[model samples]
Target chain A: MQKVVKSFGANTVLNALDLDIAKGEIVSLIGPSGSGKSTLLRCINLLEPIDDGEIWFGGIDISVPGYDPNPVRRRIGMVFQSYNLFPHMSVMENICLAPVRVLGRKANDTKAQALALLEQFGLADKAKSYPDQLSGGQQQRVAIVRALTIEPEVLLLDEITSALDPELVGEVLDAVRNLRNTGMTVVLATHEMSFAREISDTVCMLDGGVIIEKGSPESIFTNATNPRTRQFLSRVNSR
Target chain B: MIATVSTLAVAITLIVAIPKMPRWDRVKKSFFNGEVLGETFPKLLDAFVLDIKIFLWSVPIILFIAMLVAVTRNSRSPALFPLRILAVVYVDVMRGVPVLLWIYLIGFGVPGLGLERPWNSPLLWGTVALVLTYATYVSEVFRAGIESVHESQRAAARSLGLSNAQTMRHVVLPQAVRRVIPPLMNDMVSLQKDVALVSLIGPIEILRQAGIDKSKFASFTPYVGAAIIFLAITIPMTRTTDWLLERERRRTSGTRVS
Candidate 1:
């Protein structure tokens, strides 16, 4: 996303924010609540459209207005803070829905792929269970697999651990870290500064809908150039 | 007093003898040979056939109109408020008045306006009345189902590159309709029962046939017999509906345990 600007009525949420994430990089967006971290991530998948900017993903310039985004979206998968699993479907069905619907794969083929993904997440036993039958962490993992089942090139995580209990956050983070290790390009918006520092190659600190600092985790965490970044990181870490 | 005594005596005899009588060729032959019973079955069958024909024609029209009304009522346009008011008024008026009155109004009053051939048909009038009344009720059911779907579900579907219509058809509506199955089935049962009211317009529906048979026979057995047949059909349907509702509830509740 380059030169992205978005506003809700008079209050702007993102202001000319320029971000470039390379393939196979894990970039963590860190900021206070309402500082446009989530909004920026949402704009990447066009969940929230940018008022002004260019979003270039997989050689498709989504920045252009009126572009057919379905093909682009097929390569970008998003997981929400609430873990929006289809409650009516079983875990395997949740993962297989988009694959069969959007990709038009046969049911047997999709199920085989879905089962493999579930087993990789150690959730093979939960394949037939509905989402509500799983714990928050398990549901988030299923949500991740649901996105990955479509084989998206880039995965967006929006405060995925914010909704989990503290004890369950580790399992979800672990699953995400595994994805990062497997060479999936990941863009995550999070309040977990420590986890961000550990898992992210690049960390960007945002405030008032603008990026105050962007650098390697070691540079941003240990030697942040901006005072606002220092203050925000202190408050986030203290929490 | 004599009439009452005769009615009670006939009821008691039928109740006692119908089931207790030994199965024999003589009794079967007598039943088949009886003029009253012979006439009653054909009339009853004709009425049943007419009832089915009316319902089949009306349900689809009513469902389409009902779905349109429901969507308009939920739309965000400036016209939505007036549409909501209109829908509410429609539902209230149709639900408040007896369906018999609507049938009479449409069947008798509409023809006086000098409409053409198809509109003048009794079957058309009766079906129009049924559809108009039932559509109002079904629209409310559809509205409730659509609203029960979470807002996040719509957002999630949109995020997945689905358009509003696609989201409604694929993601939101499937879940919403599943949630409202019990209510929908209840409406269908009510629709079946309401078909009996069409007989007031001189249609030869089941209740009307039963009434004609009672008048001609100078006996009430055929009327009671028709009642028994209605019970036989509706009881199993109602039980099946109950079973489906219970199973759905169990499935949803069981999923919430973890």
Candidate 2:
């Protein structure tokens, strides 16, 4: 994606932000709250229309006015912090819904794939369970499964573990680790500093809608860095 | 035991006091006599069937129209601006006007416009007025339901490449409809009673049939019979609404495992 701008009324959440991720690379966006990490992910997914600038994905500039976002959105799956699963639908149905309806795939084929994903995620028994019936970690894992079922070119996760309990966070992070192992390109906004250091190919520290520092985790976390990045890391580490 | 005794005492007191009331004799002749009640019962019951028919047919159509209006009005698309305005106008006008006036305007006044047979039928016009009026109220309930769904659900669905309509149908509306079931049922109960207003337009429904019988027999028994019929249908529905609301509260209040 190119330099993207997004605003809500007077608040400019993303200000001419530019970032690029190559295929099979995992990029983690780390930032303080209101620092535009989530907004950046949303812009990349086209969930939020950019106020200015362009987002080019798969040879198409989706930021143009009147351009259909649905086709591109299908190629870029996103999961939310709140585990926004359809509470009324079962886990299996939730995973199969977009594949069957939006992709126009056969129901049996989609169901088979959904069940396979469920089995792979250790949620095979939960395929018949409603979201409300699942624990927070389980629900977040299901949310990721739902996004992954569409076989997106890039997966964007916005603080997927933010709402999970400390004990539950590991299970959800494990699922993300598995996704990365399959060579899936991923862009994520997160507070999981250690997890990002362990799995991310590159870490970008965003402050006030711009990437203040970008490098390998070892350099950013331990070695010399920009003063703001150091101060931010110290604040997070202290907590 | 005390509650039971208090209830029985109130009932016994009412029974004993009935004969001593100044209008007892006339009340007996007008509302209690077996002959008047028996004579009016079947006819009022028959007319009540008309009320039920109108209610049955109008409710589904009203709900369908109300869903359309609510969805349209909730849209933020600039392209749907005119449609949204029209929906807002329909809800406002229909809700602002009394059902009686609507029945009069549609049933009596519209015929003066030289409309043909179906349009001139009092039954059809009366049904139309009820549909127009109730659709507005039901649409407001539906709008509340739709708005109550969280924004994250929409974002989640849209992120998966579901179109706006698809998201609403699969993710948003099912949850919204479940949340609004009790309120919708409340509107339905009110609709059941409001159908009686259509009687003013000469459709010969329950209350109108009772009026005719009362004038012919010089008795009020037929009105009591009509009241009984309406109670039979509405009381159970009201109870069901309460039961549904209680169930929803319980389900929502249950603690989620962290």
Candidate 3:
């Protein structure tokens, strides 16, 4: 992604920004509130249309006007801060919805795949349960599974654990950790400092719609150069 | 209990006070004469069958058209702006015009065009008018449901690569329609009563039959009989609406979260 811009009315949420992601890399975006982390991820998933610049995923420039976004959106999945599960559906139904309805996959095969995934994630028993029947952690994990079922090339998680209870946060992050072990290309905006430090190969500190610093987690967390970076880290560390 | 005594007191007061009025005899002869009520009641009942027929035919058409208009107005696609505008116009105009005026315009206007056979039948045009007008009101009910669905649901579905139509069908409408069932039935009850509006144009329905009986017997008892028949159907429907609303409230309160 290069020189991407996004504005809502007069408020420019994402100024001219540039970034790149490598295959099989976990990139974590850490920022204060209103620092454009969520907007950046939403732009990558084409959920929010960028006002200017190029978003090249694989080889296609998806940010071009009139470019069909559905094709690109299909290859990049997103999990939101809110679980956003279809409350009317069972966990199994929510997982299989996109595959059957959008991708036109056969129901039996998809269900079998979904059951396998659920088994792997320790949610097999919850398949028949609706979202409201589960804890917040379980719901967010189901949301991740729903995104992953489509086999997207990249997973964009926008503050996925922000809504979880403190005790429940670890369970949801455990699922993301499992994705990292599989070498999934994941980009996430999160407030989980320790988890991001542990899992991310590249950590970018953003402020005011741009990444002010980007480096190995060891360098960024331990040997920060920017004063804003140091200030931000201290504020978070003190919390 | 105090409740029973109050009810008895009010009833007794009405009984005593009503007969003491100077014109009570004349009013009783006009509106409550048992002999006249007995004579006209059967004719009103027979004509009410026409009203029932109109209600039955109009219900499905109204629901289907309302769903279409609601969905049209709900769409965000720029390409569908024309259709969205037209839906707005339909909801505005149809709701703005009184249902009786619609019956006059369609029931009388269309047949005057010299369209042949069943096309010109007042029965058909009046039903059409009722369907068109009531659909707008019902469509607003559906729109309330559709909008009540959070924007996050759309974001979730679209983020999963579902197209707008697919998301609406597989995700949004199912939830929206579930939320709106109570309101939808409320509109149905209102439509059931409003079906009597067709009588003004031609159909010889309950209200029209009451008019006929009023002249024949030179008394007003048939109108009361007509009111009784309408209340008979509407009262049960109103209770059912209340029951549905309570059940929906319980289901959603227990299970649904943001």
Candidate 4:
């Protein structure tokens, strides 16, 4: 999202935010609550409309006013803070739902791929279990695989582990770390600074709906240029 | 009056206690003899036939009209608010009035208005009245079910590359229907009972047959017999409703377990 502006009535959540994520980079967005990190992620998939901006995914100008977003959204998979797995569907069905319905893939083909994804996430045993039957971390991991089953080019993670218990957070982050190894492009909105510094190729600090600082993980962690970034990091690291 | 009540009590007790009572056998013999009593059996059968005809014809038509009303009420188009208000008014008016009045109004009043001539057949008039009155109620039931699905589900579906209609058909409706099945079943049971109101229009339903037999015999046995048949049908339905409610509770609790 570049020069994107989104306001609810008069309160601007994203103002002239400019960002360019590379083809296969894991970029972590860190900020205090209500800093528009979530809104920025929402705009990339056009879940939330940007008042004035350009979002270019691959070669597609997704921000073209009045353009249909269904095709664009199909290529951009998003994981939510709440996991958002369909409770009525089993883990395997949740993974296969989009592929069979939207993509019109054969049932056998979708099932095979869904099972493989479940196995890859170490959730093969939970194929028949519904979302509510799984732990918070397990549900989040399944949610990630659910998005990936559609073969999206960009995966948006909106604080995917924030809703999990502290003990369960590691399992979800580990699943994400495994995805990072595959070189999938990821834009993560997160609060776990250690995980962010460890896995992210680049980190962007946002405050009051604008990017206040941006750099490599090492630079941002050890020597933040902005006083706000330093103070934010200090408080985060202390906890 | 006291003597009549005492006689009814003794007859009921004998019928209840003695499964093979000769008095019941005598009534059965008279019914099979193809005389006045014989007419009761065929009349009851005809009533059942009429009930089936009403259900088969009316349910689909009601469902189609209800679908249109539900979709209009839920959609965000320019006509949404007016459509919603119209549906609400329809439900309120139809539900508030007795079904019998609506039946009379549609059967007698519509043809008097110089609209298309009313259906000449009593069966047709009854079916039409049932469909018109129940469609409004069922439409509201459908609307409530559709609205019960969480808004977040819609958002999630939209983000998953589904169009607005697709989201409604696939994600929203399935979940909503699951949630509202018990209430919907209750409405259907009530509709089945309401079929008896067709007797008011001179169609020979079970109650009408019972009434004719009662007037001819000058006895209350036909009324008791009809009550027994109605109970036989509805008791199982009531049991099914209990089972459905329990199943839903279990499913919801299971979902919240983790």
TM-score of each: 0.78, 0.93, 0.92, 0.84
For candidate 4, write residues B1-258 as lDDT tens digits.
Answer: 999999999999987877577586666644333354444655665666666567667778987887787777788756478877887777778778878888887766655565543446555676678887888888778888899887767767777787878888878887776777777777777877788887887778788888888788765566666655667777798788888777755653354334
Model 1 C-alpha lDDT per residue in residues B95-199, reported as the tens digit of each score: 787777888898787776888997777667877888998888888888899999888777666666566666677777778778777777778778887888888
| lDDT (Cα, tens digit) per residue for candidate 1, span A1-239 | 78899999999999999888999999999988999998898788777767887888877788687787677778888888998888887888777778777888899999998888888878999998887778888888888888888787788889988877887677777777888777899999998887798889899999999888999999999899899998887886777
Per-residue alpha-carbon lDDT of candidate 4 for residues A1-239, written as tens digits (9 for 90 to 100):
67889998899999899898997899999999999999999888888878987888887788888789888878888999888877777888788878888788998998998888888778999998877778888888888888898888789999987877888677666777878777788999999888798889999999988999999999999999899999999998888
Interface RMSDs of all predictions?
2.1, 2.3, 2.1, 2.0
Per-residue alpha-carbon lDDT of model 2 for B54-146, expressed as tens digits? 999999999999999999998878999999999999999999988889998887877778888877787788788889899999999999999
Compute the DockQ of candidate 3.
Answer: 0.59
Off by over 4 Å in 3: B1-29, B248-258
Model 3 per-residue lDDT at A92: 94
Candidate that scores best on TM-score:
2
Task: Write the number of the candidate with greater DockQ, choosing between 1 and 3.
Answer: 3
Place model 2 in a CAPRI quality band: medium
Please give the RMSD to the true structure for each candidate, in Å: 8.4, 2.7, 2.8, 6.8
Q: Please give, as one word, the docking class of candidate 1.
A: acceptable
TM-score of 4: 0.84
Worst 10 residues of 2 chain B by lDDT: B249-258
For residue B180, give model 4's deviation from the true position in Å.
0.4
A1-239 per-residue lDDT for model 2 (tens digits): 66777889999888788888888899999989999999898888778889888888877788998889899988999999888998878788899999998999999999888888888778989888878778888898899889998999899989988888888677766777888878899998999898788878899999888888898888889973699889888999999
Residues A1-239, model 3: lDDT tens digits? 89889999999888888889999899999989999999999888888888998999889899888788888888889999998999888899999999998788999999999999888767999998888778788888899889999988899999987887887677767777888777789999999898789878999999988889999999999999999999999999999
What are the DockQ scores of the candidates, in order?
0.27, 0.59, 0.59, 0.38
